[model samples]
Target: MKKYTADENRYENMQYRRCGKSGIMLPLISLGLWHNFGDKDNFDNARTILRTAFDNGITHFDLANNYGPPYGSAEKNFEKIFKEDFKHYRDELLISTKAGWDMWPGPYGNFGSRKYLIASLDQSLQRMGLDYVDIFYHHRPDPDTPLEETMGALDQIVRDGKALYIGISQYSAKETSKAAEILREQKTPFLIHQPRYNMMDRWVEEGLLNTLEHEGIGSIVFSPLEQGILTNKYLNGIPEDSRAATEGSYLSESQITTEVVEQVQKLNDIAQSRGQSLAQMAVAWLLKDQRVTSVLVGVSKVSQLEDNIGALENLEFSQNELEEIDRILKKD
Candidate 1:
């Protein structure tokens, strides 16, 4: 193990909240290695962001087996850092990784089959330079694979001490209920469910929120800023360095139409009334539901992270403000 030291004192401003009924307490804001921190990007900059996140109370760093431009590069980069400045601070961190998406070229490289699931986690563990990850997630649902096989693999992971908990991402309410029932029967803790939720996207409000609340499972919504569309960066037009002009598979030109811009402007008016930017207000909005344990945020630079971290300064949203926002964005 490499020698390192973390400022155990910063735990003061850093708030850790319980994940629903589970005893696991995660930091209010978690950093995600979804776009940056890959071999295709600058390693030094990634290191800076990771350290900055740690310095600013972000203890959880989320990654997956296939988060990079060329799959597995994100985990490989994280493993390199874990072997360097992060080995000794391992106990102080909540590093989570996932599988179940398309990884390698072969059939065994993807999905939730026991063969694929277990093997993918093995690769993740090896790439992260750890015997186990605190949270292991199934990236998406598998329609063909039996839920029992997936649950069994998760059970084996905990039984063998390879993962402390198992989570599901982008799962529908039906699948979530089914998985929760089986896991509860086997005395397994379904820790968290990650979903793409934001002011622009209110799909989860239909039923997913009630499902998680009823089942007592935790939720950490991603894309809460809608890939930075809520920010003032696009008020005029797409800047050259924005995610739109970059290699973004999620945020593209087709998404930024006159209608989206108008809705964003109307929402911005509401955010300004609250004395917050649209991005900050959006982040604050997600935390309005106490059921949401954390908001997984992605950034391209330290300044972006700093601005995002400032969202904690103001989290309150009044009923009228929410109603006005709903009028404009609920249908968008």
Candidate 2:
């Protein structure tokens, strides 16, 4: 096949927001490679998703070391596609990868130690065939490791030029502040955070968002659709082809209770009333909060990407609608 050429007017309809105090502005919607783009997945489909994402001005691609089912295969697969398709547009993209989870079969393979993070990123860069990543994150907070050690390692990562910016994912508000202070003292570019935030999961609203705001750090939320529960696919009960129906899926069928389904149905009705799909409404709801820099959405197909991006079209909500949504979500 011929080399992939991106759409010249990709930025025309897409909106960009400044990432906190940073000069970098990410698209309203970013692509997350947590689900697909693995060696077990179809290469052609992954190509289509990447192409469609770039065509729609999604310059940021979020990845992690343990994203693939077998782990690290997603980066290998993406390296192939990126080298063939996106090598020329390197400067135009924000590529991020994370560590701090189980990766290899050794004591040093996990957590936020300086050794683990540094070695993981080196392997990540090698797998992605990139000299450096835009952002490298400590996938999660390490309860055992000293915060200074992790932050110092991140500071070192920036100084080493292995990554341009450093971030921490799944950290508590207190932890975020502590890490931010350490990174600030070290003069590291503590750019953004990756947290699982959605209409279903509002934990970030407690204090994480505020901490990020006060510290001038950006936030990119993942699982914006709550693993497809926010979409219309669950309105009539889980389809056999859905994620909930798959064995050993994170979103198990048991999680889809009757009451949860009822709430989603009501939310879907509200979305329809606003001329948007349930998934679109969910994405828009997150972006309506000024603290959110971008909503990280993972999709299996190109059509899903289009529908998710459509959330940017109508992000405004009236007071009544906000109250109604709050009422519906707060229900037991």
Model 2: per-residue lDDT, tens digit, 131-240? 99999999998999999999999999999999999888999999999999898888899999999999989999899999999999999999999999999999989899
Name every residue pair that clashes in candidate 1.
Answer: none
Q: In candidate 1, residue 48 scores what lDDT?
A: 76
Residue pairs in collision within model 2 = none
TM-score of each: 0.95, 0.99
**Number of the top-ranking candidate, with lDDT as the measure:** 2
Cα lDDT of model 1 by residue, 1-332, tens digit: 22445557657776777898898888778999998878889888888788778888888999989998678899999888878888877888998899888988888888898888788889888877799999899999999999988888887887788899989999998899999998988887689999999888877888988999999999988998898899998887788888887774678977888888888898888888878888888898998888889999998789888777788888888889888888887662
For residue 109, model 2's alpha carbon misses the true position, in angstroms, by: 0.3
lDDT value, candidate 2, whole model: 0.94
287, model 1: CA deviation in Å?
A: 0.3
